[model samples]
Target: MNAIEIINLTKYYGKNRGIIDVSLQVKEKSIFGFIGPNGSGKSTTIRTILNLIHPSSGEAYIFGKNCEKEYNEILKDVGYLPSEVFYYSNMKVIDLLKYSASFYKKNCDDRINYLSKIMNLDLTKKIEDLSFGNKKKVGIVQALLHSPKLLILDEPTSGLDPLIQQNFFNLLKEENKKGMTIFFSSHVLSEVQKICDEVAIIKEGRIIKIEKINNINNNNYKRIKIEVNYKIDDTFFNNIEVTNLIKEKNIYTFMYKGEINSLITKLSKIDIINIWIDEPSLEEIFMHYYDEKM
Candidate 1:
């Protein structure tokens, strides 16, 4: 059974588009990544699913229960971390955690302690004293304390340092191994690429692509620069599948998209001394998609 199902789920805020005809299903025990830029309705969709906000139309289900009707029951087995962290400033870290843990019937001290150590959160500090990163860590601990079956985290690593971000990923992976379903929402391409098994890219409140991460064409075009001992004919540019070609003296730089075998064969015929090929990063790939949509 899918852990979550959103069928034609849509929301509108006074005629302004929140999301339109959005439909998605997250499989049980899988890490699903929801990706989009700002004002793309990601948070709106998440809130609707959690029943924190009412949807104007369509339906959402968690564990086969209607989201709106069964919100209380569904929430009992779900943990959520919002995009923003808010708590009483005067409360100590331990006090805040205890208050959050009180919502669940299960004892959460051991889980809280374990997470504190794993995340390196200082329980003695007051909420107001913690840095942004530390405050996010506290939010993480509270979300996991009850050992919820499903975790919904929105921009979970926003303020975390690199080390803590890595640790958080490890924690999610470990939880998934124990049959937990993780729904991770983020705008960061690298974060989604590294941790998500499947990802859905949303733009302007619409899903543009939803596919297995392995299926994405991450092998984008490469930029190649070549320098030869002798000046090669400009005719080389004519035969080569090159874009944005630049030539000066004996040096040439261009972008190539197809198989490298043919390009390599052509290069071998020339007295090439220096060469460089720039591979695209995740950010570039994401931008490529974004540009295509525009």
Candidate 2:
């Protein structure tokens, strides 16, 4: 069964479009990545799914229940962490957690204790006194303490240190192993690449591509920098699909597409001194998509 399903969902604000005809299904027990640039409607879609805002058109469903008609029941099994967290400044961490826990009838102390130890969160400090990163830790604790079946997190790593971020990811992996479904939204491609089983890329309020993480063409291209014994004319590399070419004396740095064997075969005839190949990063792949949209 799908953990969440959105069908032809659309939203608008006055004359501006928020999202249009966006449809997606998140499978059970999978980490799904909702990726887009800022203001691309990722948050809008999430808010609509949570029933925090009414959709202008279309429908959203949680576990086969209509989002609007069964919001209370649906929310009981879900935990959400918004991109921006706002807490009462004067409240202590323990107090805030206790207050949040009051909404559910079951005791949550065990879950809270487990998460606090794993995240290394200090519950003694007041919300106002905690650092930004620590406050994020508190948010993480609250979101996971209930042990909700469906977890929705938006930019969850905003203020976390590198170490804590790694720990949090480890925790997510553990949770997924027990059959939890996670839908996380972020523009950080590297983090998404690390944890998500599947991803959907949105551009200009529309989802342009959806693919399994393992299916991505990570081997798109390579960059080669060669130091040649003889100076070559610029036209020698013109028809070679070369990009970002930099030449200094007899050395040339350029990007190449396709197999290395063909390029190597051609370069073998040249008097070459040394060469190095650079692989493209996830950021470079994201930028390629963004540029296509523009």
Candidate 3:
């Protein structure tokens, strides 16, 4: 069974729009990335999947059970961390975590302590006394203490330091390896590139693309730089499937997508002093998506 499935899901608030026909499928034990600009319905889709808010049309299912009808039972195996977290200001950090753990049947004290140590959290402090980063750590611990089957994170790295973010990602990889499926929602394309097996890109409250990370990169344009021993005519690279080609004395650089043999054959005619070829970053590919829509 899929970890999460949405069949033409749509939601509306009075006359306001939420999402439209947002169909998606997250396979079990897979780390799926959900990406979009702010207010683009990423959160709305997640909320509907969790059954936090009702959808006006279509339906969502988790582990083959209808989300709207089986949310109570589903919650037992799910952990969620929102873009923003809120808690009783007066409560101590440890107290708040204990209260949250109470909702689950397992005794999570040892798990709580273990997570706190790894996250470098001070559970003795009052909730109001912690910084935003610390509070986010608390949320991270809260979500993982029960070793849930599924983890839903929304902009989960906000306010986290670089070291903490690295540690957090490593921890997530460990959990995912242990059979916990993950749904990561964020605008940070770099992180998604590094972690997700497949990515779903949403724009203007609609899903525009869903594909494997490898598939996206395999067809990605390559950036090439060459320094010939002698200068070449401007039209020498004509019909070579290049973009952004620039020439400076003996150097020529551009983005290439055509056959490598064609490029090598052309370059063999010249005395090349230096050459460089590299894969474009995920950020470049992400920008290509938005640019094409324009």
CA error at residue 28 for candidate 1, angstroms: 0.8
lDDT of each: 0.89, 0.87, 0.89
**lDDT of residue 71 for candidate 2:** 96
What lDDT tens digits, residue by residue, belong to model 2 across residues 80-100?
998988899899999999998
Can you give the lDDT of residue 196 in candidate 3? 92
Provide TM-scores for the models.
0.85, 0.87, 0.89
**Model 3: pairs clashing at backbone N, Cα or C within 3 Å:** none
Residue 74 error, candidate 1, Å: 0.5
Lowest-lDDT window of 10 residues in candidate 2?
Answer: 280-289
TM-score of the candidate numbered 2? 0.87
Q: Which parts of model 3 are misplaced by more than 4 Å? A: 226-254, 266-274
Q: lDDT for model 1, please.
A: 0.89
Clashes of 2: 0
- Ranking of all predicted structures according to TM-score, beginning with the best and ending with the worst: 3, 2, 1
